[model samples]
Target: MLPLIPYALALPLLWATGPTAPDSLIIFNASRTYHYQAIFISPAGDTLSRERITMQPSGQPWVGQPKRQTACTIQYRYNPGDSLTFAARPNPQNQPGRQPQAYEWRKSTVTGVIENPQEIWMHPIRSNQYAYTEVAPFPQVRPADLHPGGSWQANRLFIMGGWGAFKGSVRPFYQVKAPATRRYGNQNLAGCWLIESVGQHSRLGNSYLDFYFHPRYGFTEMHYRFYDGTQISLVLEGLPTGNK
Candidate 1:
């Protein structure tokens, strides 16, 4: 048998030889600007309208509160060092009267994290509608490490200004279907991870989300269905374009 070594002496050797942590599940390039197309669908399966969305690194931090009565009591801050801003604008090609009233906002910006890369602000129902704000205390949208068949679940809080606050829960299941190929008009894309999340809200009932995420491109496609029969879909127009 080999001679035993002191714990302290062996610790460094063990760490050096141990497996290194895997790469992050998703990667964001602060220098690049991402573009996406948002499609609004009515409960009756009709297409309501479409909007163009652009996501980029924010130069300035974001500070605001949910439009709640307690807005004065609570404030949320998103620093530029670790967050991205998503801006939505009306599509010039859209037909007249095609845009819904809730989607009329010309400039809608939402903030998401760069580390975990999950939307921390805005309701999932409509793009930048600001109907409600979500705060996930656990914030487990995806696993920290990338792998096939990874899954996670967590609780989320929903705060609606003037409508009161409610508690909610979210369970996300992820699966790596196959190797990446030409998708969303982009010939170069990393592997695709499909995630399905089932959410239960204390007051709003149930909601469902099915989205495809790319490590290098972020979310390539997303489909959301709310309790009130509202449905929205977002698809990346193509690979992001910008310096670096």
Candidate 2:
């Protein structure tokens, strides 16, 4: 079951401002767009393909329905109505034999009141292969104080289907690690909060996600390890430039 803490008790701590406070660490700008490069890696550590991804705020309300009702509810920092749209296109120079055209564009809604918001719902805009709707909410209660070593668990209803279908639950146990620098392209991102999680899926087996959130850059990097031994890394490439 999802853990619950009264909102009245969490509000004061969530709004407190400081270098390590949750308010300062979790920042989102709804008006700005984010660009990233998605690198698909094989189980052998070879690069399989690359795609350019763009995420922009839609400024629209959440109107989609979940496959099952959520088990928990809590007030979110961002309006529940707000959503983000994500589109991905194959990089010009992708690996040969890789079908870049298989990539699909998605619209997703995120909800949570702490460091990282869980993607509760996802809809494909260009493809009819699969979708995800949260059947449960993430835990609202977190450490009273935010700092390295702080830990929490977030569980979501994992519902995916289309040509193939699977319905189950995924719970990722998250831990806050010390800030560090990571290299992306020609730039070195420093002072990024390293948040890591490990979880087991009913259909996908075991997996893990490493997320790096920058104080000023928001979500900068995400590394995913799937059960099948495939790894996908998404690195922020900054905002789109020029006419793009």
Question: Which candidate achieves the best TM-score against the true structure?
Answer: 1
**Highest-scoring model, lDDT:** 2
lDDT of 1: 0.42
Candidate 2 local lDDT, 133-231, one digit each (tens): 111122222434136998776534344332122244556576878989877667787887787767655665666667776655556777777665667
Query: How many clashes does the backbone of model 1 have?
Result: 1
Deviation (Å) of 106 in candidate 1: 4.0
